[model samples]
Target chain A: MSEGFGLRSLHPSVLLLYYAGGITFGMLLFHPVLLLSGWAACLIVNGHLDGGREWRSWSLPMLGAFVALILVNPLISHRGRTVLYYMGDIPITLESVVYGATMASSLLGLLTLFVSYRILMTEHKFLFLFARFSPKAALLAMMAAGMVPRLRRRLKELMLVQKTRGIAVSEGTVTQRARNGARLVGALLSWSLEDALQTADSMQARGYGTGTRSSYPAFRFGPRDAWTAGGLFAAAGIAFTLWANGHGYLTIYPRLESFSLSKGDVGALAAYLVFLLMPLGWEWRDRTTWRSLNFGK
Target chain B: MNLLRRKINPKLLVIPIAIIYLVLAYVSLTRGNALLIGIVLVLLSMIPFVWRFERRQRQARELVLIAVMAAVATVSRIPFAALLPNFTPVTFIVILSGVVFGAEAGWMVGAVTGLVSNFFLGQGPWTPWQMFAWGMAGFTAGLFAHRNPSRRRRLPLLLFGAAWGYLYGWILNVTVALDVGVREQTWSSVLAVYSLGLPFETVHAAANVFFLVVFAPSWIKLLERYRRKYGALQRTDSGSADMEGSAHGQRTAAE
Candidate 1:
């Protein structure tokens, strides 16, 4: 179950919609508790996906950038009334610090979500979404995506071949190296141009865009996907309603707004937490099911 | 004459809309919202326009040209990824695409390059914005292509490339600022944001100028030669028909 059922098993539209909603809320909501919860959920989900190894490398740089943002916000932005400190005529305040933290949380949450997205949503998934809109554009995008790594390897080969010929880009003055680089690109252009012509001929022969085309879909929108999408929309609806009503608004401006909790706040928090944890919950359930089935087997 | 019947200059419309969006984004900063709705709106509106621009009857040669150009631009980012940080042949390729294939193709190539390259580099919030910036860069280049035909008039292309370097950096900086939520009405905070990014903008501009001066001529000539030879395969009659239709529309609107 764990191997078979995870975020990747979900329909592409479901996964895309989930990210769309999550990323939207992550960017728009500034409530501290909500943001911190979303950020934590992102970290945990990312940990489960990558076995927490990346956080070790990510911590140092994420911390550095996070701290830089927090410190820089207060120094440059002289907002709010509660002055915390002063340095040579500049005043550092609490509101800016809080604002910086919220901003950092949003930024980090977004980064984490995108990392997980990159792992789960493969190129075909993206192209599937694009192909629904425009088949030709998607084909072009597919070609371009496939061309990059190929060209990188080709460039490396070109570099080695050119190096042996004594016209390498690496071994020269800056201008000479640039000229060498330009030459390599020129050679690649003509080479790929001919290759592309062949491809065009092949595509023509295949009768592309001649009539209605059918695709071999790798995944289907099953009942589970529908249920997941329904749950997502319901959670998003509740969360958006709470947001519109100012249930958990955090204001850090000319004056710092005190963090308080109410009945509506609790509801908003619950809804948001459920929304953020939806994918993780699926993964956990699948993992547990896998453990039980394996033991029985 | 009905006011709605007036033909609008599509080229002139984009700049004013962009300026309005920027102004609204600036205002939103002071209004306590972290969301850059203005920029979001600008980008959202662009999607349908770009889609419509490409949903035309095109020859296989034109389609092949767009695909090849997008592939080249996407691939060109590879070798330079190590040589010059954040500087790639994408802009040069896209600009040359615009110059040779005209504005619609330019926009497609620019936008497609962003979408495809991010598959390798990883996509984020910046992906759509990058697409918009690169698309606009290509569109602007195409806007000037008619006047700057031939490799002889290459200075304007060079200047355009250099200007876009800073412009792309500035727009991306706004994305960062949106994250930071720097909404002070005074110029100091904005100045700080710009100053913090000044070094990067400088490097990007220098790289753009260098690439343009170095490779623009050869690439432009190569693409132009292709366009002249192969592009005319099925476009010879329809291309003129399109120009004549636009002229007729403009003339009727004048009357």
Candidate 2:
């Protein structure tokens, strides 16, 4: 799974399925808890699916950011009825704390999912998905996405060189730090100008932004893709229906509301569960098929 | 270094810069006021200055250096300012551009930094103001590229930079206040808002002084070294020597 599901190797259809599922889930659910839970599930699954090495590197920072969000958000936005305490003209409240936690969770979930997608989805997949719409735009998007990691690497190299030269920026006075930063910026600008020209030249040589364009063929809507997409659509439909009928949980500010579930809501939720489980099923089947092929070998 | 020495045709930079300017103009004209359009036009005008440098050298190395600087300048401003002191590294960045690549490069750095930084800050009518303020700061810095080095003379340049820093913030505040429909067009109202931004302005000015004091000598040394090692400084022809001598004499007196 680690090798096959790597971002560079993932099929475009698979990426599309993930995006469609996320958007549908986001739109269908309004309850803060459920929305947050959905977001967490996406993040954890995304992180785990990418494998342990990547997860290990990101987990600490992710946790730190989450804690920071929880601690900081409530302090700044102290607005609620249930006052927990008062500190120097500022009033803290239970509602505000909960709201802050929920917001943090939501953001964390989004970040997790985004990071997972970034690590799992490759430029090839992105280009493949959008190839038919606008080839030049798609190519540009691919280039932009690819540029992030490359730019990061370049900056790291520059920082190291600066450090070696005894121009330690982080340890300096505010003014000295600013000067050091300026020197780095000067170097970086000179670097990027050259890159942009090369990129433009390379792109132009290939007839980018021309009237017509060609693409490499890799994406195909197979049975697995069909099954995944169909399940997502069905789940989306049921979720939308539940949302429209006001059957699912709803919460307004300062008031918690949970509508009594009907037989229809139960059915819709059951369908959602099945839709969510479809990917797990695909993973199982693929594993089983591999085992079968290797039997007695 | 090789890239900095290579010659780039000025004409090539013209089309790309013009296209960007026209697009900015169109956006402002359609969605904003004349003030916004005027700001954008001023910012866009900096492109020609950048092109002037490119006309002499089309080296990939120089191009990369400029682009990376622009990106760093853009990224450095991303984090929320409530926690940090201020976002003033950009002024220093502009100065560095002038020191390393000359005036044209400095102007380009400012313009690109403004435009790119706006992407994360939320793009709208205010982008042009940010662009012009930073671009002007860089252009002003570049104007002093040939100034001789003396502590007394440097003091005024530093003060000039500091003043430019505050002036930029004041202009930005006015433009933004107008855009948001605050409608307090009086001097008092403008002062009230601009005064609030004093901390940020002070930080910017201080940053400029800091950057200039620390890096100016090093930059001058680097340029001298480059001229010595690679023989990059153009030899003054006999006819031009007299003109250069007078200019040199004036610079010496100024120092």
Candidate 3:
């Protein structure tokens, strides 16, 4: 549970918009420069939050797929004209290479953005956003998420106690291990089903469905949140409008365009960066506030 | 206007909007943007179901029962996180949840299990697809179990589980496979993607069959016993479908 500070402290709706816009623009603008820039922004934001710990942890698989997409696009759809080289009979086109890199960057950008999303959008925050519209699902998901740890702990206890009954799943033939795992699960289910129902009864006793449910720790949409949201939408509007005019996308089909950005593309990129990094304004403010309080001149 | 509002379900108004959006997407976006189309369709298909579940008042026991089922499905993955790659008991539990609980509860359990499990594993583009696939598995199980789910019926469930094993793989793989085929407009490209997943699909199917054969009967009996004990979520018996019954307190399922 990473604490909500800086970007995390923002209202959940604002956080949701940040990610939604980040992903939307990432998909909308297929240019390599724009995609790479968005990914870099995500990395900077990730670093600002947790010193890139979470980002680095997820970087390997994301980068692996990132590289895979870049390499595989040229191989799979051999449609472009500029032949770079030949591997056996397969010709690699410059257009395809560019397309691959564009896709790779887009994938990386989206995945990196989600890394920060998972950090910021914890279960409570997610429920906060959804509770009003779908209270039942939100409550159910909340309860289920809450039970996961207890259930896992119980399963661990089951595995240990049942190990004495010659039901060790860790060390045995594949079949034996699989069978033992099943047995442990069966026992766990019976124990949990009985226990969970009791909790349900306790809940009913306490007037579980008595009144309309209220969201806990009700997040207020403060003036700061409004400003952040406004700035975010304004920037997003510009970026989206620019893209709608075909400014941000790098066309690489049957022919390739220069990697250099046009005037409108640069403006689009600026709007995109502003929208992405708006939360960082709060992060910066918080950092300065902390610094001044701790080590003031 | 009030009469018109009552005539048409305001809840389902998003369908035409989604259709128009999809048509616009099909017209404007490239072939590769089908992932977005798929996600829109998935959410559109799910909205009415979710909206209905939301409006319908449920008992504490019913809600908790679904929660426990989802939680268990998620936690069960922990013990086997590194076990045989395709052999997780999640699908087995989900299917049994449907078979015992009926379609709505089954779908919720499966969907919630997918979502909550991803909270631990990782959330990504694939999460929605997984939720839809697994939820449908539970839903179909409920339907398959029919009115009186018999403990003697192992073959049908085993087959269902096995089929979902492949079906699950197909659901996950289809979007990407179609992307490839749609790009090339060739059957070979799609087949290549499908064939690439053959081993995983086979193992998943086999694992589903294996678990259902060994565990389905007892699990079904256990869940049914609990349902009868709780006297919650029996809103309908097999044939009558009393979903909108006013009596929330009584044992609604006919003995």
Q: For residues A1-297, what per-residue lDDT tens digits would candidate 3 score against the true structure?
A: 235557777888788778767876777777889888988999999888788999888889997988877777777767777999998998888987887788778878988998888888887788777665578898898899998989889999999999888897788887778778888888888888889889899989998889987556656666677789999989988997887687887877778978899999999999999998888998889879888999995
> Taking the tens digit of each residue's C-alpha lDDT, what string does model 2 give over A119-155?
5554456556554433332343344344444655666
Please give, for residues A178-281, the per-residue lDDT of candidate 1 as tens digits.
Answer: 66776777777777776777677777788866865587676676777878888998998898688667665577777877777677777787887788778677
Which has the better TM-score: candidate 2, or candidate 3? 3
* TM-score for the A chain of candidate 1: 0.92
Candidate 2 has a DockQ of: 0.08
TM-score (C-alpha, index-matched) for candidate 1 = 0.87
Best by lDDT: 3
Comparison by DockQ, 1 against 2, better one: 1
TM-score per candidate, chains pooled: 0.87, 0.51, 0.90
Which scores greater on lDDT, model 1 or model 2? 1
For model 2, state the Cα shift of residue B199 in Å. Answer: 12
Cα deviation at B191, candidate 1, in Å, is 3.1
Residue-by-residue lDDT tens digits, candidate 1, B180-254: 444776666777777887777777777677878877777777876676555433231221345746644543363
Q: Show the colliding residue pairs in model 1.
A: none
lDDT of 2 by residue, B1-255 (tens): 224312654235547746754564454333322223444455456545443442342333333344555665665432213223664556666655554444445565666666556433433334557767776676666555533344224565577667877878776765433422222224544455466568888877776676556655665464334323322222211112335567545534643
Lowest summed lDDT window (length 10), candidate 2 chain A: A132-141
Clashing pairs in 3: none
Order of the predicted models by TM-score, top scorer first: 3, 1, 2
